[model samples]
Target: MPNLLSRGLFNLFFGSKRKAFEKLPGPTPGVLGTLGDFIGPNPWDVCARYGREYGGVTLIWMGPSPGLVLNDPAVIEEILLTRRLEFEKGNIGTQIRPTVGDTVFIANQGEDWSAKIKVEPMAQPWAAAWLAALVGPLQAAINESVDALLKEPSIDLTPTLRRLTFDGFAVAAIGEKTPDSVFEDFMLLAKGADARLQAKLPLRFVSFPEGFEAAKERFYGYFTERVRRARAALNPSAVDLMSWTLREMPTVSDAWLGHILGTLFYGGVFSTSTTLVGAFHQLQKYPAAEERLAAEAATLAGAPLTFEWLRGAPWSEAVAYEVLRILPAVRIFLRTPAADTELAGVKLPAGSTLMVSNQHLHRDPSHWKDPETFEPSRWLNGGTARDPAGSGYFFPFGRGPRECVGAPFALLFLQTALATIAARVKVHVDSTEPFEEGFFFGVVLPKGVTGRLIARPSQAASLPGSVHPSAAVKTA
Candidate 1:
C-alpha cells in the first residue's frame, strides 16, 4: 500500500511533534489512521466511545494530522472562557465564513471583531422586546402550520418548523414571510461550503458542487433585495435587525449589514430546525418524556401562550436541555492554540489543533449520570445539573465571545415550538426501526424521521386556529 507507506513515513518523521499527545490515551488508529474514526458509518459514536474509552485528554489522528480531544470540563472552560482570546474558531469557522459572513458566529478574536461583540448585548434586549411583540404573529404562524400538518397521517416536521422559525425572523427582521424554498436553498449553499471546506488541502484543489454558485448568488440576492427594501421603507420600525442596525449604525455599509443579517438567518434557522427534529425524535423514543411535556403543556389550557408561560413550563425547559445536550447541532468546536501552551500538563504547540467535542463533553460519564440514557429529570432542578454553559461543562451554542449570539433567541424559539406542538398535538415515530442520527455538512440530521401527528381531544376546546375546531381563537 503506497498510500499507507507514505502516511507511515510522514508520521514516523514528524511524529515527535505529537509526542506529548501520543502519551495520552485514545483509540488506536487502524490501518486507515484516524480517517477510520471520522469517515465511518457513525463517526460521532466513535467520538463518544473514545471519551468513554480514553482519559480526559485523547489524541486522535485525522489521517496524517493530529488533534487533541478534550473531555475534561476544566480544560473546556480554559479554552472557551479563560484563554478564549488565544484560540480562534479554526477551520470549521473558516468553512462557514463565506456563508454566515463575519458575524459573531464566525468572527475571530481581533480589534475588528471587538465591535462584533456588541451584537450580543444589543441583540439580547432587542430579541426579548421583539419576541414579546412577535408572540401573537409567531403563534398564528406556528398554529397554522401545525393545524395543516395534523390532517396528514405522517409528516416530516423539519421543513415546517424551519419555515416557522424563518417566519419569526421575517416578522422580527424582514417584516414579511420568506418562501420555504429560500430556506432550502440556503441550506444547500451552506452544506456546499462545508464540503468545499472539507475538500480543502495545502496543495490539492477541488471544485464546488455544481449548483453551489447559483444558490449562493440567489442567497445573497435575497438579502441584497431585503436590505434595499429595509432602507427604502418610509417609516422603518426598530423591531427588525435590519431596521435596528440601519438606525443605530447609519455609517455601516450595505454589504456589511447583509452579511450580519445573513449570519443571523443561517444560525437561527439551522439550529432551530435541526434541534426540533432531534427533540421530536428523542420524544418519540421516550414516550414518558413526551407525556411529561404534554402534561405540562396541557396545564396552559385556556391561558394565553405568553413568554412567561413558555419560560415557566418546567418540563419544556428540561426537554430543551436534554435535546441540545444529547444531539447538539454544532458538534465539533475546533480551536487552534494562539501560541505554545500546556493543557492539563500536556504540551500543545503553537497552532496545534485543539478540538472539544460538545457531544463527548456533554455525554462524558464523569460529568453526566448514565450519560447514554436520555433523562430529562437530570436537568430539572437548576436546568444545568450536568452541563452548564456558565460552568463550561455544556455549551451547545458554544461559549465566550464566539458563543452563539442567537442563543437566547434560540431558547425562546425552542420553548415556544415545543410548548405549542406538545399542547395541541402528539407526535409518534411511525417507523418500525430505531431512528438513526445522521451528520450532514454541518448540522445533525435524523434520516427519514417520519412521525404521526394526532391532535389531542382537549386541544379542540383549547387553542384557537385549529383546523378541526370551528375557528382560530386568539390567545392574549
Candidate 2:
C-alpha cells in the first residue's frame, strides 16, 4: 500500500521533469508502438521509434510512470558500470515482491544487494567444482529430452524444453527431480504471476490458490531444511552452492538458502524454456536460417559438443543471441531510482521508474545494420560494431552489479540443449498459423502454436574432438 502511494506520488511530482528523457515529445505508447497503437500488435515498436527520435538515452511513460529507456551502448555501459550504484529495481521489483520477497529482484539496491553481491555464484567456476559438474547433468537432461523427441514426429518442443530445463537445473542446482505434474502446474501459476508482476499492473482482482503463498512457504521450509541437511553432510571437497555459501557466510540462515534455491529453480526453468521456444519459432519463420543452422549441425564434431566445444560455435551462439535479442523472455526491465539522480543528463526526479526493452533495442537499425532482416550471420560475423553503445545495450542477461546470476547456467542450457537436439534430429518446423508471440506466463512463448517438426538422423560431417556421434556434453 505504501509502495503504491509512494510510486504514485513520485509520478505526480516529477512527471514534467522527464520531458528531456524521451525521444518523442508527448505521452508514451502501450505495447504497440504508436500513439494509437497502444493495443497494437507490437508494443516494442515504440522502442525503435524512440531510439530513432531520442539518441542513446531517452525517457518514456508506461503503466502510469516514466522510465528512462536507453538505446546507446556507451550510456548503457555507464549506467551498468560507472554509475550502477545509483539505481534500484523499480516497480517491476515491487510487483514481483509477492514471490521473490527480500530476494535480489526487490533488493536491487541498498546494503542488502551489496551484501548478496559478495556471495554471487556467477561466472565460470573452477572446472572441477560442483558448479562445473553441472554441465554434465544439464547435458544429460537435454539428451534425454531429445531422445524423447524422436518418438513424436511433431511435438511442441516448447514445453518439452521446459520440462528438460526444470529437470536439468533441479539436478544440477539442488539435486532434485521436479515431478512434471507439480512443476508444470507450478510453471503456469508462477509464470502467470510473473507476467502481471512484470507489467507492473494492478493485481486487485487477481485470484490464486488458497494455499499458494503457504505452498511457497512450505517449499521454502523444505529448501532450508535440505540446505541444513546438506550443510551437515558437506565434505571438505564438495563444491556445491549449499556448501560454498555455508563456508563463506556461516551466519546465513534457512531463508536465504531457501530464497537462493527457490529463485534459481524458478529462474532456471522458465527463462531457458521460453528462449528455446522463441528461437524455434523465429527460425521456422525464416526457413533459410533454420536450414543454415541445420547445415552447421550436420557437420558438427563427430562427438557431441562438450561445454567447451559447444560454447564456441559462432552460428549456434548467434542463434541463441538472436533468440534473446528478438524474443526476449520478458517485455521490459524496470528499475527504480534509489534516490534522486541524473540519467544520461536528464534530471529524473528521485523515485521515477527506469525501463529498457530488448525488443526495442534489438530492432534498432542505428546499432544493427539491418534490424528487420533475420540473418544470423550478421550477429555471428560481427559485421556491425559489437554494439553502437556498448555491452549492456543489447544485453539479455542484464548488466553490471544486478545482471543475472544464472546466466552461465542459462547459456549452458541453450548451447548444450540445442546442440544435443540438433545433433540427433532435424527440426522441420511446420506451423498451422504464424507462431503467435507473447510474454505468456511472463517467460514468453507463442500464443497458440500447433506445429510439428520431423527429427531425422543426419549423417553429415562432424567437428572432430569437440563433438562425436552419440557422445554428449551439454548445458541448461
Top-lDDT structure, candidate number? 1
Question: Alpha-carbon error at 442 in model 1, in Å?
Answer: 1.7
lDDT (10s digit) by residue, model 2, range 18-115: 44555434334332222243355554555555667765566555444455666666666666677777876656554555665666555766588877
Clashes of each: 2, 24
- What C-alpha lDDT do the candidate models reach, one value each? 0.69, 0.61
TM-score of 2: 0.77
- Each prediction's TM-score versus the true structure: 0.85, 0.77
lDDT of 1: 0.69
CA deviation > 4 Å runs, candidate 1: 1-22, 29-33, 119-125, 200-204, 234-238, 244-254, 299-304, 385-387, 432-434, 459-476
Report how far residue 122 has shifted in candidate 2, in Å: 3.1
Leading candidate by TM-score: 1
